[model samples]
Target: MATYVLVAGAWHGSWCWVEVARMLEAAGHRVLTPNLLGTEAEDEPETTEPLHRWAEQIAEIVRQEVDEVVLVGHSRAGLVISEVAERVPEKIDLLVYLAAYLLQDGQTLNDWAQRAHNADAMTNAVAFHSDGTCTIKPEILEKIFCNRTSAHFIDFARARTVPEPIAAFMSPIQISHERFSSVRLGYIECLQDQAIPLDMQKAMQAPFPNVMTEKLDCDHSPFFSMPHELVSALERFRRAE
Candidate 1:
């Protein structure tokens, strides 16, 4: 059985992948939902670490596994998994992006996001603060992220989201062809995702070819809206590889 590491995006924790991890475990595969450093609600004000800290955490998790791992990143986490692949390419069996920021070397997540300006829902959805942290607009949270989720889950998600550290979003990821490009990649497109639109996802992926792809007809928050379908897509990634 393959080990799966599910990394949540900003403002979220291991809680986001609850259902996905549970389903993967039931199928006899090992699953890890690792929360980034200082991302918990209580850690909001103190969350000053950059994106690479999350990458280091995932790489350590991969080292714990006896074999290669399927690294899955959601939304903003696309950046984190990419960094992890650079650190331990051999330990990673496949790098998976679920409606995430699949940026290239020297490109910051902010650089890719600005192309949309105010057209996409994600631009104004986040409010930046002087303390180098950001907060999601509660009103727009469900709209851009969980619009397709059930009413109960929408509430479930809203209450759990915490403030995010902004340094990671602005930091340029250090990767290279000799290291980062050695790992195989996969992308799971959330066609209905408003947080990161289909066009943006395609643009981020344009630089990388021969990457495995899967599609989901759901919002950005598929973990809450389409966990079964998300698991199905992940299973497809395993089979394809």
Candidate 2:
């Protein structure tokens, strides 16, 4: 059985992975849905937390695990998983990205957002603060991230969502071909994703060859809207990859 460390995206807590974790655990997988540093709703974002810190935290989680780990990241969390995989490539058996921002060595989330045609839906939703924090508008969150999701989940997600540090998006990622490329990459592309559209998802995977690809006909947040399909895809990675 693989130990899965599922990292949450920006403005989201580990709460988002509750249902998904439940399903994975039922299938005999130990899942760790760790809320990244400062992702809590009540936690005040006084100072900016950069990308490396997020990556280091995940790396530490991987280091403590004894079983082969499948490191999964969602949305903004893709950058964290990629950096951590390179940092401890030997421990991470597989890397999974769910409509995430998979950047190169010098690329930042801002760079990819600018390139994505439908990024306005996500970028426009951001409400930046003078204190160097930002959050997505609640109204826009429903349309972009939770489109077609049940009313219950929409409320659950909104209430738990918090402000994300601005520096995390602006921080340039550091990954190398020698270390990062050695590990296998799997991407679950959400075709209807308004946030990170299908085109951008394919473009991000283009740089890396033999990245096992899977598609879901749902929106950006598959774990919420189409969890069964999402878990099925994850299981496919373990068997087919």
Candidate 3:
């Protein structure tokens, strides 16, 4: 059985991966979904922790939890996994970016977002807080992140969502081909995604010529909209490796 570390994206906690983790566990694979700092609380105070702190938290979990792991990053967490791989490459067998932001070395999420075709809409939708944090308005959350998902799941997510620290988005990721690109990379694209459009996902992935790509006929929140398919895709990726 393979071990997997499922990392959630900005404004989300490990709770987002519950259904997917359960499915993976049922298939005899081990999975760990660690909540990034500040995400555990629905109303956590604006945080000062840089993006590296989030990566360190994940690296610590990787060092202590499993011998080796298939690190899966969802949404914004694509950057997080890259940073974690830099910190502990030997502990990660493969890096999976699930409709996530796959950034280049020294590129911040802001930089990537600005280059995206949907940049104007995404930027306009964000409600920035005075404390260097930001969040999507609840009214638009469903449309943006869970458009194809059921109402029940969208409601649950909205209730659990928290403010994401802006510092994390602004902090550029520090990675290198030697430390980060050595691990196998896979990308699962959500075809109907509105949060991270299909074009943007492909653009983010273009630089990584060796990355294996898979597609799902779902929206951004595949863990809720199509957990079984997501699990199947992940298993197929693992087998290919």
- Cα lDDT tens digits for candidate 3, 31-130: 8998887777754643675578889989999988647899999988998999999999999888999999999898988887887778888887789988
Best-performing candidate as measured by lDDT: 3
User: Top TM-score: which candidate number?
Assistant: 2
Model 2 TM-score is 0.97
Candidate with the larger lDDT of 1 and 2: 2
lDDT of 1 by residue, 11-46 (tens): 777998998989999999988886777777666454
TM-score order, best first, reads 2, 3, 1
Runs off by more than 4 Å, candidate 3 = 42-46
Decide which is better by lDDT, 1 or 3: 3
Question: Which lDDT tens digits does candidate 2 get at residues 1-241?
Answer: 7788999888887998988999999999999999888777666663555588888888998999987799989999999999998799999889999999888998899898877777666678889998889988998888889886888999998888898999888888899999998888999999888888789999999988889999999987888999999999998987774
lDDT (Cα, 0-100) at 233 in candidate 2? 92
* Alpha carbon deviation, residue 167, candidate 3 (Å): 1.1
Q: Give the TM-score of candidate 3.
A: 0.96
lDDT of each: 0.85, 0.87, 0.89
Summing lDDT over every window of 10 consecutive residues in candidate 1, give the lowest-scoring window.
41-50
| TM-score (all chains, Cα) for each model | 0.95, 0.97, 0.96
Misplaced by over 4 Å in model 2 are: 46-49
